[model samples]
Target: MTKEQPIGFIDSGVGGLTVVKEAMKQLPNEHILYLGDTARCPYGPRPAEQVIEYTFEMANFLMEQHIKMLVIACNTATAVALEAIRAALPIPVVGVILPGARAAVKATKTQQVGIIGTIGTVKSQSYYQALKAKQQEITVTSLACPKFVPIVESNQFQTAVAKKIVAQTLQPLVHKQLDTLILGCTHYPLLRPLIQNMMGDGVTLIDSGAETVSEVSVLLDYFQLANPNPLKKRAIFYTTGSTALFDEIATQWLPITRAQSKKIHLGGTTNEI
Candidate 1:
């Protein structure tokens, strides 16, 4: 695969932009094609089977774009669909869970680590499994913060209501005295300040998006897929839902130009070009 072929990234919504932001910083010369399934936003509450189907639909769409590689940017989708996507696709497929888990284990000074993510991610136990695979003695405490994604997507990170909801959702995990906290979901990083304030200064906040980018860097090198043009990279964003809302939030959080979103029907007779 040549570097001219864009890297593909897919998420249930705009959350994957966090991963794309990190990739822009790390792999500046590599063009990227990001797809956001905004029409069916919040894969957190969906059944595992439905999530898997949606994930495949998006992955196949990206494959149709001739993406050189695939990055499953959504934690819920990664948990439910990474393996299947990897098996179905010819290119290397990377996901956030394993990299984040490895980073969490490496950053933890104490054996006790805390994780907060969507219900689907937490239920899948992907982080717990990955952490245990590295060190059996490490203790993992996971909480399902289903409301956090919507709050960040709505651009309400610093609002009083958002803080209140965060406090309520994180109260259980805060009581566990964890020295390190992993922001399991890509959207959760936007809530870092609020989460850090609530968790205090001592707890280390791990952004999975950042770690996932590092893994992507390593993979690109291993596969000899690094772009030759170090300064001529471009990142493009697409969404199946509200382009206006995605553009508003993306401009505020990411350093990319305006996203050109196109409407897509799930499981219908429409093709993404």
Candidate 2:
């Protein structure tokens, strides 16, 4: 694969833009292609098989564009489909979970950590397993914030409504004695300010999306995919839902130019990108 080819990132919704923002900052020379399955968003509650089907469909869409690498930016998707997709794909694949887990494992001073994600993500036990795999003795507490993604996706994260929702949802983790919290879902990073506020100054928050890009940078170099003799960066975003809403949220959270987002359907083989 050549560096000229864009790096692909996929998520259940605009949450993946968090990763795109970091990639733009860390890999300024590279191009980015992102697909948000907004049509079937909040993959949190979906069955694992359904999540995998959707993840592969998104990956196939990105592959058609000749991406050099794949970053599964959705926590639920990473939890359910990362391994299967990685094995099937020829290109290098990266996911948000391990990077965040690795960072959390290293960051926690108390050996007590917290993970907040979607229902599917938390139920799959991906983050907890990933954390334990890295360091067997780490104590983990996880919560599924089913309400968080809708707030972010609806472009209400900075609103009082969103704040109340975050506070209500995060009440449990506040007293968990955790020194570090993993924003396991890509969408959670969009709610980082609210989360950080609730978790307070003493608790460090880990954004899987942000951390995933660091690994992306390293992989790009290791795999000889770093763009050389680069030009101005470019980003192309696609969604299966309303482009207008995606544009609104992405403009505020990502480094992307505020343009009309392209719409693409990802389902059975009959669907087109």
Candidate whose TM-score is highest: 2
Superposition TM-score, candidate 2 onto the true structure: 0.96
Best model number under lDDT: 2
Model 1: lDDT equals 0.87
lDDT of 1 at 100: 90
RMSD of 2: 1.4
Candidate models: Cα lDDT each: 0.87, 0.89
CA shift of 66, model 1, Å? 0.6
lDDT: worst 10-residue window of model 2: 264-273
lDDT of 1 by residue, 166-194 (tens): 88888887778899998989888888889
For residue 98, model 1's alpha carbon misses the true position, in angstroms, by 0.4
* Candidate 2 collision pairs: none
